[model samples]
Target: MKTDGAEVLSKTVTQDEAAILDAWNVALLEGTSLQSGRIREAELQTQVKTVFGQLRDALASGGLDADAAGFASLRETLADISRSRAIQGFTPTDTANFVFSLKEPIFDALKRMPDGDATALAAGVWAAGKVLDRLGLQTMEVFLASREEVIGRQGQEIAELSTPVVRLWDGILALPLIGTLDSARTGVVMENLLQAIVDEEAEIAIIDITGVPTVDTLVAQHLLKTVAAARLMGADCIVSGIRPQIAQTMVHLGVELNVVSKATLADAFAVALKRTGRKVVRQQASTEGRR
Candidate 1:
């Protein structure tokens, strides 16, 4: 009895081999059926070579393609066998590189399909692309999240020391203040100063106005809280970069700042040094007329 083309293509040494061969056949047929040309010249040439080689071997072994269906079956079976053998020899890294290299060919294959098949093929490719993109984004996000966790943990370590933000003169630390506060960033101001004080064991903290845009009653309260907190921690929180408008608003609001030591950044630093027992002694010159 003579075996038909489909039967010949379907034959295997074992059931497991048959299953593997069948799966490869399906994948090759599905992947290449709509592709233009025999194979993509750049990346898929190896696949082409493998398939052609296998077909030659099969032909020499007396495999016959009796009809169009039989011919297609033989062609796909050969392609599958070739692709599988080629992949089998690849190391994991090589496999990854190979896949990466195949991206263009894969895309081209989808683009060249017949109109009826194009939509379905394109849709499948698009879906696959989306899944891959999402997976890549998630991977990057996870990596960044992990890095943030490490930085946070490091921050907690320093925070444990209760070091104030003032010490940052010798280093850099970003303070991201969020939400509305009464007294115009007073508490945060104080907390940052005190943290600086403890951390740097410094006499001055530059109280930043970048975060505070207004001076309402609540703003004043918070500022007072910050000042008080700084004093208690033995740090002079220097209010810096006060906008002219904000200062006017403070005056109009009639908020007394007597209890809170005030200065433009420079004066604040001078005051800070004074409070920390560092005085700037001035030298007086004697008049020549006395001689």
Candidate 2:
């Protein structure tokens, strides 16, 4: 049977080599699998050659100490592969599998260390795990960033609004705040909200925070800025669904949200209708002040 390059690389691993090669395969599958099969095959072939060359070089040196050096080189090769594979479209399971496979060789290397060197090796292994975790997180972030870019290029009419958990009754745009609000997202939210306000010609914007787990002073400030920008565009922004914990944090941090209107989404809708001169009751107040 004719095997593709990826299949060829997979075939190169023996029962003994499986554990070491597993992590590299996982990383590759995670980072570059979204691309063409030919691209993935080419990248995997290069990675396998590099790792195999390292192992061959280490084994060629003749000494009792050669095994330890070989293991160290293998560990470094795994780390390199893990880092290189940190691209968008990779899954967490792949990353986890790769990291788990390293445990055995890492422990083996630590065991072979000199008496006083054991602590250093253990620390090094721990650091390597952290590096892998960071790489995985960075890969996911790149994926999200790419998604945002695609959405941006699709144009306003075709771009679908992000559905929030709650929406206003009077067609107000809803902004669902979630995760850590770094400066990058802050800018994105600002641009998106403003453009949405203009595009939809919406009179009210309801920012619902039911999904946000926590808030800091910076995030609070970002929210405030968004509200201010909306008002400048002649659109009222209502911040609703603030969690009790986030409210407390805002108070503790001494952040004042004075200008931005605060209420539940329903209440904001009521207020927005009132601002737009849409009376709940069409009939004017009776002369006796009875509806």
Candidate 3:
């Protein structure tokens, strides 16, 4: 029976599965030894065996195309492996090398096939290379996509963490703006402040922008929107941390924040306390001094 290159390569890999796996692992380690601590060799060995087993089965099934329906399971497995490696801090080269490294072991197996001429061996090697190349490219694609998702989620978490609502007093909530207020961050800020107000049943919410570097018309509009949202929630809003430059810019830009304004958070808090009919007085010295 005259078998094609794909059949010859797949049969050899399945027959010498253990040796091929060992060689593949060695090649992979050689390529990524610098990242030795990122993953364990044993775990990598298991994953290697799984992927190789799937590849061998698919090739033996007479479908050399990596994207064929027969290779769907293999592609899914590679995507999972790529995503895992990406989250484990593996570089793209390291991730794709997981598929590429198998090429050498399969090629070596092809060369050692019994009764096979040099031409046949080369053909088998070429076929295996094309398949592995396709699989490696698939891995890289999945790696990039997984990395993007991780970055997006991390950015969202940072935005949420940056916007925290604090209860300054019983009837006062403070949202200290620290970074640039874009539309997205403004929405998060408004949601957090409004939720805090309802939860605390607060009557005043102070938005302090001491950390804000500049105030443009857009920023003024965001502040107004937040103030409007808080007022709709039955709480008055105070805007504080108005530097001379920011005040000047707001006036020049014809941007009006139709809410109580203060130059400092302390002043805003004091105003809130007075509006809520609360007072903070210093304790006098004991009368023993007068005695």
Once fitted onto the true fold, the runs of candidate 1 whose alpha carbons sit more than 4 angstroms away are 1-104, 107-192, 199-219, 234-243, 253-258, 269-279, 284-291
Clashing pairs in 3: none
Measured with C-alpha atoms, the lDDT of residue 35 in candidate 3 is 57
For each candidate, what TM-score against the reference? 0.35, 0.43, 0.89
What is the alpha-carbon lDDT of model 3 when measured against the actual structure? 0.88
> Residue-pair clashes per candidate, as listed?
20, 1, 0
TM-score quality measure for candidate 1: 0.35
lDDT tens digits by residue: candidate 2, 1-291:
332322222222222354455555554555534343433666665755575555434434322232255446655665555444444334445533434444454344334444435445545455435433443444344445555665576643232343322334454777877666667666777888888787777888888766667777777888888889989998888787777777888889888776555546566667777877776763556566554
Which ranges of candidate 2 are over 4 A from the true structure? 1-171, 279-291
Candidate 3, residues 1-291, lDDT tens digits: the string is: 454777767778778888888898889778773456888877887888889889888988885788898899999999999998889899887887788878778888787788778777877887898899999999999999999999999999999999999998897999999889999999999999988998999999999999888899999899999999899999999999999998998899898888899999999999999999988765667654541
> Judged by lDDT against the true structure, how good is candidate 2?
0.57
The better candidate by TM-score, 1 or 2, is 2
Residue 179's lDDT within candidate 3 is: 85
Better of 2 and 3 by lDDT: 3
